[model samples]
Target chain A: MKTRQRILHYTGEVVLILFLVIFLIPLIQTFFTALKPDIEIYKTPVHIFPQHFSNVHYLHVFTRLSKDFISFFKNSVVITTVSVFLILGLGSLAAFSLARIDFVGKGFIIFFISLILSIPLIITVIPIFMMETAMGIKNSNLGLILPYTAVYLPIPLFIIYNNFLKVPTELEESAYMDGANRLQIFTKIFLPLIQGGLIAAAIITFLNCWGEFLFALILNTKRSATTLPIGIMMINDEEQSWALGPMSAVMILSIILPMSLYMIFQKNFVKGLMEGSVKG
Target chain B: MKSLKQGKKIRDNIVGWLFVLPAFVFLFSFMIYPISRTFILSFQKFNFVYDSKPVFVGLSNYVEALKTPSYLTALKNTLRFTLWYIPVIIVLGFLFGYIITLPKLFSSKLAKIVLFVPMVIPISMSCYMFLFILNPQWGLVNSFLANTIHLPMLVRDWMNDPRYALKIIIVVTVWQRIGFISLLFMSGIQGISSSIMEAAIIDGASAARRMWSIVLPNLKETFQIVGILAIITSIKLFAQVVAMTGALGPNSAGGPANSTLTLYVATWKAAFINFDMGVGSAMGYLMSLIIFLLFGLNFMLTKSERA
Candidate 1:
């Protein structure tokens, strides 16, 4: 029986390691493919590992598709960075207000957001698209940014609220007694206290904005306004023969910024992510 | 003091709204406003190809969408894929999370990073990866079956068959999303204490027994969270499909007898490719209604279960 239990434990470990390898292979394939030259991509039974890789594709992507690639990269970076900042800044205050301040309609507002957050995003898609087209901003960066914020709002706010609820009411009362106004109290005391939660929220919001696909695709058809995902997809969609290498390069390019940003803050990434997931 | 407090409260409210103003305006403009317009636009007939004036046509657009055979087909495919995708993502993801929690076995951190990487990559990229792997022309899998499996015909065009195409679409999309759901389940699982499981184990139960009897019962919260995210993300399974199909859309019957055409892709083609914004908007509205009905019961079930 003791030997049987040890065998089960060993079996579990081996299965997990194999599963881990399966998970990492795509990331590995990405880099391996990125390093390979264009000539190798079309070779039958395409080289899983190029015998000799050149940086030519990367340079080609940089120099040839540079203008289009960089612009889309810039667009994605700007939207993600700005939207993340807004989600954290706004999500913090609103969560605080929602959590601490007892006011009329607070329960309804909380309930509404909770309900809205739970539903699959299809509910608002039609309304948002119609609204954007009517306002004549359907194809602009504003179009992508707006929807991304709304979609990401609930999770961050939930994070902040959860963290806030854990703090004792005395913290707020102490600040009040110190003659600090409510805004100052919130900005100075509560905000700083929830810094870990805020970092988690900001990192998550940024990731969401960075990865957003649907709105970015539909709202920005024009090349100049294109975000990275659309740019990569659009290039492949153009039916160019040498589409694979350049498209892969673009795919790598678009995801690198977000991926690196994620890697840097990966610890917070899981924490923020896991919190958001269980709530909804 | 009372008046002073009132004035201070007013100021706080002002500052608070000011902070939240950007997010509110952004959501209002893009989310709230566009949704409102789509509701109204679904009633208007617009010739997208000719760029004609959109005339308000009441329920006629909805009626038109309902009459179309493809609308039903896309709806059927969407539900089928959702059904296929959600159950596996939720169940396997939960199981993986449960296994990782067993005695802290060999560090879940590395496992999580590797697992969730696909969730972050461009959908187009993963689409390409799967496309290459499943390609019939000396593709990796085809080559494998030809040599090892010893049947050249068994290396079928995975993406070209109607019956197989939808399943491939469902599988590909589910693969991209499973990592994130698993990570989520892990986090939620972590929040659950091991004492309950310890009690069960001490009671002489097997791990599966512990999982079913104690772990799973405690994991209801995680289940709810993963359930919602899975169903929700599965709705926008478009860019990847379009990438796979070469974007001819309904123009070429969406390939393999149009079996892979999702509601989003169909609606997109209706507006842009077919150039019928009326039908497109109608497609969007109808799709939303269908998603609501299918997921609504699950949502309410989870909600009521929580209460």
Candidate 2:
């Protein structure tokens, strides 16, 4: 029986390793592909290993892709950073109100927001594009940020709402008993309690805004205002046939921040996703 | 004193509304307003560039979507993708979730991180990675199949082929997203109390029996969430399609004979590419209707289960 258990355990380990390798191969390929010289990229028999390493692709990504590549990166950083903070701030306030404060039309507000959230981006982009263009905000960071904040508001709002609901009422009640006003109580007590949810919401919102392509593509037609995904797409479109190294390098650069952010705040991301999933 | 109390009551309501006002303002402007406009546009022959004065077309746009062969093919493709994609996602999600959680799997942390790398990498990049690897003649997978595996018959251009284009896209889509779903399922599985499992074991329940009777039932809500998300994500598959097949495919947006054209891509082509706003808005409404019904069904199912 002991031997059988050991065998079963060994089999589990083997299966785990096998699956890991299968999954990691593509990522490993991307890493190696980014390193390979143009000569090696298209070579016959598909060399997985680079015969000679070169940084030409990396150089080209910085120098040759576009004069506004850095601007694209900057735009993405600025847009994502602004949108995430707005979502968190607004979402938390709304969530706090809905969760803790008994107010008129709460159900209607929640239901309406849910309905609004369900309207997919494809359906709404036309009007958003036109509105932004009409308002003269199109091709600007504000064009993307406002719509992103709106699009992402519901998810974080709901996540934070659930977080607030789960907070022990005693914490807030004590604050109230100690002569705290509603605003003070919210800021001083409730905010501190739901820090995890806030972090999770921030990370998720940042990731969403970072990866957002369609609206960013449509709204920001100018190269300077575009985000990383759009920049990457432009690169892909320009050099569809080859330029694998530079393309892969740009791709790698675009994701490094988000990937590191994910790794760092992964626990919050998971907690937020799990909570959002369950509630949603 | 009563008047002062009334003032405080009004103040409370004001504070409440003030707190929620920002999100509500944004939601109303971007989401509600645009959706309402899209709905209105669907009924009118409205092309911003062409139509000087938009004329009411009634259901003509919907009629166009129904009648147009490309739209129908897109409809079919979207449905087929969802049908094929969701099960694989669910199964893989569970399998990976379960495997990673096994205590016997040495260095599970590294394995988990490997599984998660795909999720963190943007879809555009991942598609490019797969594009290189799945290349027909000189790609990694094809070469491996021909030389290492000795299976020359299976070798083919995956993305360009009409038959395999959508399927390969599905594979790539699943590969990128499965990590996220797996983590979700892992959490759900862990949420299932170990004490319940112990009770099942004490009752002489076999592992399979325990999984079926205890674990499966407990995972119903997770299944619902994961299933709905999978459906929504599948429907939203546009960028990957663009990344895999360049914008200028044979039929445009859907690659070689429009085999890979999805509803979202079709809608984008209509509005943006074709500059036919009315038809595009109509397609958008139709897509929204399908998504609404799917979400509604999910909601109703959960409601019924609770009842």
Candidate 3:
């Protein structure tokens, strides 16, 4: 019985390790390929490790695609930042009202917002394209920011609303007794209590806007306004045909921001996902 | 006194309105308006370029969309993709969930972090990474299989071939998504009372029997959530197809022989590439109808279970 138990434990460890390796192979391969020179990319029997490492690909991306690359990065940063802030500010306020305040038409409104969340972005892209173009913000960063904030509003709103509900109403009533106005109570008491939900909402919104491609692809056709994902897609199309090295480098660069963001806030992000799923 | 009371009531309503006004404004403009416009456009022959009057054609667009071969193929491919995606992801997810939960694994948390790393990277990056690794010539996957394993039979051009194109996309999608599914399952597993497991063990039930009779049944909610979410995400699949194929595949959207064209991609081509807004709007409505039905079904199931 002891031998059987030991065998099972060892076998499980081996299987887990093997699975991990298989899971990470693409990322590992890309890192190696990103370090190789253009000529070595197509070398026979694929050198998993490059014989001679090259920083030339990274240099080329920074130098040659510098304008497009920087613009893409800047656009992604500004759009994601603005969208996240808007969603949080508006979502929290709305959630405070929905969860705490007595109001008419609240049930219908919440149901409507949930419906908005359910609709696919693809369905909304065309009309948004037309509306933004008509309003003359289509090619601007604000164009993408507006739609992203709206589309991602429901999730954060839902999360924060639940967060507010979990906060004790007695606390708010006591704050009122202490002469704290509604705004003061909201900012001082409720916001502090729901900081976890706020962080989760912020991270999810930022990531969603950061990774957003379809809207950015369709709405922002100008090279200067394109976000990182769109830039990666465009560069991949143009460079993959003749130059795989630079493309790999840009791809690697594009992945760093989101990866670090996730790593830094891994716990909150996972908490957000779990909470969102439970609501679903 | 009556006027004072009415005024106070009105003030309360105003305060409530002020709180929710900002989010509602954005939601109304972007979400509600676009959806209504799309519905309206579905009934008209509105092209952004050549149309002058925005002529109303009344269901012809829907008929045309249904008749189009690409749209039909996309619909079929979506169903096919979902069919292959849901079951594989659920089973693999539960397996990983079980593995990491093992007490003997010293670094289970580290293993989980590694599994979830891919989730942070955008689909575009992951898809392109797979494209490089899965390249037929000089690709890591082919090289490993052909040389190290000495099994050339298993090596083939995965993304370009008609038979394997959709399957390959499914593989990458599942790979990126498995971590989330596993996490969901892990949460579900943690919800299970350990006392129940101890009771089963004391009753001398084998590990496999305990899992089959106790664990699997207890995970019914996780299975439902994972399945529904997987189906919904798969239905919206676009970035992976575009990045993986570079829009150079057959039909300029899906992979070779149009084997990977999904409804989302098809709608994109219609609206942007062909400038056929009417057809695109029609397809979007049809797709949403299907998704709505799925949500309805899921709601019914959950409600019934609760009852």
Candidate 4:
């Protein structure tokens, strides 16, 4: 029986390793293709490994292919940063109230947030586009920022609210006994305890804002405000589509921040997602 | 003394509303207002191309969408995609979830991270990578088939081929999402009581029997959640189709005979490309209605099961 258990364990390990390798093939291929010389990229029976590696694609992507690439990257950074900040601030405040404070209509507010969560973005984008146009906010960073904050708020709110529930009520009571107001208690006591939750919420919000394509595409048609994903899509224009190496280079560049965030704060990301999923 | 207590309760109510006010304002402006506006727009005749003012048209847009072949095809394709996508994700999610949680697997952490890598990367970037890997002339699949395996006859342009385009889009989306779904399942499996599992093991149940009798039954709520999420996501399939098929141009998103056209893509094309706001809003409204019904139905079924 011991031997049989050992055999089962070994088999599970082998299957897992094999699946991991197969799963990473696309990502590996993207990296390899990005490094290969342009001529090799066009060669038949595409090489999985670059015979002669080159940095030309990276250079071209940053310098020649898309002159506005830096601006796009900057837009992505600024927009994602600002959106995450707003989401965390507003989400935590609301979450704190819902979780701790007893008020009339509290249950209705929770129900309303969940209901809004169910409304998919595709249904809402057209009117948003029109509204942005009418208000002359189209082709600006604020246009995407406002909608993104609204759309992505529910998940973080719930995650933070759950986090708030886990904090001991004694902390709040003690703070109140010390003559601390509600605001002071929130900032001084509860906030420190829920740091992990805040990080989780922040990471999820950052990833969503960074990767959002549709809103960025429709709202920011101008080069001045286009984010990374839309900028990458723009590389598919008639002239640049054939430049596979440069395109792959651009793809790699776009994913670096998200990949690193996932690598470092993986546990927080998983926690946030699992919490949201169970509630969902 | 009672009046002071009452005053404190009123203050608490005021504070609670103040805290929620900012988020409420944003949700109201972006979500509630836009949704109502779309509903109203669906019933009007507004075409940007004609430079015409909005005119109230009663249900004509919805009637025309039902009659339109392309819109109908888009709806059919979305349903078909959802039918194919949900089961594959569920089965694979369970398999991977179970495997990664196996005892003494030192590589479980590595496996989980690798599996979840795709979820963090943007969907459009992944779709573009698949686009390159499936290119007919120099793509990995065709090249490997033709030159390495000598199966040249089997090679074809995948994304542009009507017979295979939708299937390719499904494959790409599944690849992007499988990791996320698997991780969700993994958490569900982990949430199962260890004592129960140990008891089954002591009872001499084989691995397959343990999984079938114990794990599967315990994962009911997880299944419901995953199913609802999968259905909603599949219905909102826009990015994959757009990024994969729109390589030529934005207008070609649902191309090669529109075999891959989804409701979202069709709505996008109608409003943005054809400048037909009424038709697009109508399609969007219908799609949302379907989504809400499915979501509500899933909840009802789960509630009944619990009872």
For model 1, residues B46-134, the per-residue Cα lDDT tens digits are 87557557898889988988788987787787778789888988888887666655565664555666666776676766777777667
Question: Which rank order by lDDT, best down to worst?
Answer: 4, 3, 2, 1
Q: iRMS of candidate 1, one decimal?
A: 3.3
Shift in Å, residue A233, candidate 1: 1.5
Model 3 per-residue lDDT tens digits across residues A119-219? 77877888898878789998898999899988888888888888898998789889988998888988999999988889988887887788887988899
TM-score leaderboard ranking: 4, 3, 2, 1
Residue-level lDDT tens digits of model 2 in B95-186: 88876676656857666777777777767768878876886765789888888888989988787789999998899889888878988888
Superposition error at A274 for model 2 (Å): 0.9
Off by over 4 Å in 1: A1-8, A115-139, A237-241, B1-19, B47-56, B147-151, B191-193, B247-254, B294-307
Tens-digit lDDT track for model 2 on A1-280? 9999989877877777787887777777777888988888887678788999998888877776656578888999999999998899899889999998866878988988777655668888998877776799998999999999989888888889999999898888888789998889888888898899899888878888888878876788777778887766665655653366776777778888988988998778877877775655
Which ten-residue region of model 1 chain A has the weakest summed lDDT? A118-127
In DockQ terms, which candidate is top?
4
Listed per model, the TM-scores of chain A against the true chain A are 0.90, 0.94, 0.94, 0.94
Chain B global fold similarity (TM-score) for predicted model 3 against the true chain B: 0.92
TM-score of each: 0.88, 0.94, 0.95, 0.96
Question: Which 10 consecutive positions of candidate 2 chain B have the poorest summed lDDT?
Answer: B244-253
Candidate 4's C-alpha lDDT? 0.86
Write one digit per residue (lDDT tens) for candidate 4, span B71-95.
Answer: 9899889989999988988998888
lDDT of 1: 0.72
What docking tier does model 3 reach?
medium
Per-residue lDDT of candidate 1, residues A129-206 (tens digit): 555777898777777777787888888988888888878999899888889876797788899897888888887777
How far does residue A218 in candidate 3 sit from its true spot (Å)? 0.9
Order the numbered candidates by DockQ, best leading. Answer: 4, 3, 2, 1
Residue A261 in candidate 3 has what lDDT? 78
Q: Which has the higher DockQ value, candidate number 3 or candidate number 4?
A: 4
Q: Candidate 2 — which residues are off by over 4 angstroms?
A: A240-242, B1-9, B247-251
